[model samples]
Target: MSPSSSHSPSPLNPSTHPWRFTWETLAHIPTLRLYLFRSPTPTALSGASASASLQTDRSLLFVSLTYQSGDVVRLEVPVPRVLIEPDEEVQCVVRSDHVEIKLSLVLPVDHPVVIQYRAAMGFSGDENSVPISLNDDLKSLSSGDVNLYCKSCSTKLTKEPLRHILQMPSLNWRDVAENWFGNCCCSFGAAAEPGFSFEILSGPMYKSAVPNVDSCNCHDNAEGPEEVAHTSDMHDLNHTTSNCIVSNDPDRSNRQNLYFGGGFVHNDTNISKDVEWVEFCCEKCSSPLGSYPYWKDRGNTGTIDGGVRLFKCYISTSTPVGGSDDVFRNYTVQNLFSNLLLESAEDEVSFRTVVRDLKSRKPMLQLVLLSSKAWYMSGTCIENHATGPDCQVELQPVVKVLFSDCSNSSEADIRLVENWSTKCHAEEVYMMTYEIEELKNSLSFGKQSMPLSCNLLQGMHLSWLNSHGF
Candidate 1:
């Protein structure tokens, strides 16, 4: 099908801005969504309207809109397959608001509709889908001793090469265990382990993977937390295990920290009481590197102590090369968080996430992933018209999300939080306050670039993050 009453062209003008564009292929039917934002003051572009057309081969699609003032907007985008030509086959819907135009495209079908739709929308098949995980540079340990330095100033933070590295489970490992094994701990032929329960805490709380203090002790003059088991046969555990870490020697404890998610953790004994946690900073630049808990909590396993968790984004690793250092590539906060959220979503089977401050455990941001496999094209109307005939639209991969800042949530948001908590539909992720602020700023900037009409969906604000290679 083609647009009705197609206009040839006049000198282009900036009457409308299609600030937000999305190409979707997840469903059996492929579709396109666009929002054209109009100015507050009606211009010669009054009575502005739009139309669409497709090339004969359907390799490219054209969109043109005309206003009462005779201004025109013309855009061309590439399609992966031929488009159905009959008017009835194509569905177009347009709605006008106080300051925007909403356009929805439902592509026509052919024999074996699903196949055609997916191909046309550029779904390259399952083999092209890349998996996201924790950053490999820090996740895996190389042969021999590895030294860690501050990414900003190259200030050495570790006294020696890390000897042994262990992986920590997710923050909600206990809940995951309970869900898989049920409330009864006898499933594995043993009672539930002490110092753990599936009950949700009453307010915001930071929970870490901590081992039993009494049983965990370092060997061979190494002051590190020892691995301990609650029972003999608890693989199919119904309760939680004390999977924590501890380190006493300040000189060598740095080599024994465990790596997990996006950070490294070290257990300490001299926790303070005035502040719940202390921010660990780089000695050279004073840049915040991580934090350790100061307050103590009583548990079934006795005084529960927290450990220092060092973020991977703020640090860099190096290996000795001919008595010199070979620094690894720098990482970003966005990439680190993206990997973490993507992995957690797949593991927890939920798209809704609550990012909290690791120290305070206060919810900082709430996000819902709408489409991990998405391509978006965003441009201003002025820029589109200014580009003239040779204008080329470049679609970039992005992870579309609906998000909201929880720093100042409303009653409705509170209710949403309660619902998520009660039903356990949202997974909690932790980061430093500064890192959370950085993520929030990135998302907010993306939202600002979009049209007012497309910046929000449902009650949450909409935004996108650059995909971690899909």
Candidate 2:
């Protein structure tokens, strides 16, 4: 085969050059780019009959770098079929000529929940940002369409919102529902009436029985009205407590008496049965004054106000009943109601925090009530103003109203006197009363009763029971 003296064509001809390439020439070629993609880890695939159905087919890849010479050559390569498994290492190798490239295929196991959450929220910008992918089965579970569990651990991973529906507090369900619907519909029905109302019964009568100036003793140094007016002009100042300033004044002691009345109404239907009794307490203090049977009068009233019409209506009997001594001493209506509102507002804040925490994937513990104090403070200011010196100077005290914390404690106590006269000027009035004995009989006899609690704030600890008709 000595072709130097022969007319044979060169084996390195252009047409055959591709078959004559050496290993070094092929080694300089660009590296093959391999891309492997698979569905999210099937922790558990719903509708699968058994664990064996969870397995997926192995993927294969091939790449041709160069045309081979007449001499047939075969390269041995090992590829990883599974990227993740228990007690297994992901190892593989690709062989070319005398060189072998070690490859490692590792599937990430700790996928973040935020990735799936964001995706579910309709994010589609970047894959690197989403570290986890939710399967259709899991998505269905979160959407209230189904329930799912993890196959390997048999753990329930998702549930329906209905499971938490019954957890609403008995006392709060009505208000909560009202607020919810208010936000949704932008209008309210008769249920939107204020929770409290009261009317005045009578009067501006003076303490004195006589209308003549001679009947009341004037101080020895006191001047007559004319003299006092002259003195005021000379002094260039007005004295607020001058007794000689009497003008034409009618006798108040001769006027007739007055009366007032009204009560609260609850619209919610769900109420718990475990509430044994309700303690009406002062709105300002936490003291317990008295206890009434739960739901005594689904619409009954209590005569806690003496002759006053202010009565304890909606009552809850199923509340855990303990000895008066066992009750918290300072539970006042004001404090309890304020606290209830505060806690609800706090929950809403915590919900927002939960949403933020989920986004950051960071655990949080401390939750603060942002609006509770503000509301209480505002209420205090208004109450103070209503009972301030200005009001005292304009109105005369008539009948006194004593407020007590219905609980066993002495912490909640309030005193208020009727000082303003009503526009009606009626002396006689009718007030309703819920007989305690009657309420007790109803509970003992298992008769239907109102689920409202007169003592506890309407929102704390009883909403769920109320909504579920406990």
User: How does each model score on lDDT?
Assistant: 0.46, 0.20
Give all TM-scores, in the order shown: 0.53, 0.13
List runs of model 2 lying over 4 Å from the truth: 1-267, 271-327, 349-370, 373-470
Best by TM-score: 1
- Winning model by lDDT: 1
For model 2, how many clashes? 54
Model 1 misplacement above 4 A: 1-46, 52-62, 74-94, 97-149, 152-275, 295-308, 317-331, 380-397, 410-416
Q: Which residue window of length 10 is worst by lDDT in model 1?
A: 197-206
* Candidate 1 lDDT tens digits, 167-284: 3334432333334334332222253222221111101112222112222222332432222212211111112233322233342222223222222221122212332444556767
Whole-model alpha-carbon lDDT for candidate 1: 0.46
